[model samples]
Target: MTPMQLDLNLLAALDALLEEGSVAGAADRLHVTAPAMSRSLGRIRRSTGDQILVRTGRTMTPTPYAIAVRAQVHALLQQVQGVLAPSHELDLTTLERTFTLRWHDSLVALGGAALLAAVREQAPGVRLRFIAESSTDSPGLRRGEVDLEANANPPAAADVRAEKVAETAQVVVVRPGHRLAGEPAQPMTAEQYAAADHVAVSRRGNLSGTIDDALARLGLARRVVATAPSEATALEFVRDSDLVVTAPQATTRRASADLGLVVLPLPLDLPPASVYLSWHQRYDTDRAHAWLRELARTALDAPNRRA
Candidate 1:
């Protein structure tokens, strides 16, 4: 085929038609009418001298040639998009965009105000929508529904990019008059800590965690009286009742003070929480997205700030 005679538009239409196997579906995918798609199919057929799609018993099927070239066409389209995509040079001051950030409730309760302030001071036109994460394996980032996700551990998907924003240790917390708090100077033994009614915080609503595993190694088990979906809720439960909960030392420090609760070192040893900022690989080169990721890192990394 000659380059001058080949219309890129026709190539796109052909690819869509071959993939959809229906002119109406292809039209919907390309945001055009069925009649327009039919006309484009005709042009593609005339230029390529191949009936890209052949009608068979009220359904369309790709011809042998069409099937052979489908992969090549898709790869070519991706190359074209990459070449035509905008560059990484951004003017944040005047950039007007709404970025959706999905994070755990504790992160929002801890760092939402600081992040919003930082974004506002730098880009007045930018808007940040903070949404609660429903699960650890959420596909929001890969689906383009969420621009960024902040969590202690990054998603396991290979297509997602993650960067460590901060780290924090876990601390045990309880109400002021709880048995564990009466003797502030004396550290509770593992058995004494395990004997108390505990409130577990998990996004999946499980009653066990790394703490329980550690306790199991020592042949001890704590009674989990309740399970809260978020750390903020768990803290509230701990504040109003005798149940104890473990949470990030830095973020929960502020909440603990606000709730008038006592913070103590965790009886069970666990690794420090590594906070991360994650996004899909598709956004790796996007200018606005790159800046937003940097802004989040800066906000969370600020002195005395918790991730």
Candidate 2:
């Protein structure tokens, strides 16, 4: 058959076959007979000039070509469904959907409760899964594994949309009686701030960051006694010892307060940390997703407003 005569049903059948790796399993998924599914798979093989799935002993395995086109085929089917699906008014009261969010621990601590409360009140049937950030980069948004992300880092992918929802200034955190935390009227100088022992917050356990670079500009460098994998852990070190930690003001406010740590203005001039809300372009027009984004924007902005 020519390309013009290609059936959309064949695409569906191909997707199912590639995913299930067996005609019988594909038939069960598409609610068709195994014989019918085999026929459709034959047609797919002829159209693509490929034996998409080959029998490997008793089990079927996807060919290299089939594996290569699997994600593209699935994405195309989803796009077609979105385009052909009728636009209906969203009914949140009875909506049953779960959105997965991968966010920084700090952002979750700051805005998660508020976002959850808003979601529960607005759409009681909707659920949320707040996941931790990964150590390495991932295509979770593009793969639809993650529905939303809130963090300081912006996505670099062209298909991922990122919006800056909030910005928070950096502040130095130390124990209440620490020397740098001395006078309320007197501000700490760059030299004074850099003279103290410090604990860096680095996911990769690096001893330095932008703060170190800024200090080097002034020919000053603070000795980092330790590096913690997270801001929470770094703050714990600050609470117990003289190790100072520079952290974002808004997100760390509650935690610092709880730890009884003193927050001092950063002596060095630096741009505020930006909190970005990111999602895949495929969700741009999804009404439910759009609603969740708005709520998230509000929730993330709350801390900055209070700051």
User: Distance (Å) between predicted and true CA of 302, model 1?
Assistant: 2.8
User: In candidate 1, which residue ranges exceed 4 Å CA deviation?
Assistant: 1-80, 303-307
Best by TM-score: 2
**Candidate 2 residues 87-170, lDDT tens each?**
999999998999999999888988999999999999999999998888788788976679999888899999899999999999
Q: Choose the strongest candidate by lDDT.
A: 2
TM-score of 2: 0.84
Indicate the residue-level lDDT of 65 in model 1.
97
After superposition, candidate 2 runs with Cα above 4 Å error: 1-63
Predicted structure 1: lDDT: 0.83
Clashing pairs in 2: none
The backbone clash count of each candidate, in order, is 0, 0
Q: Report the CA-based lDDT of candidate 2 relative to the real structure.
A: 0.91
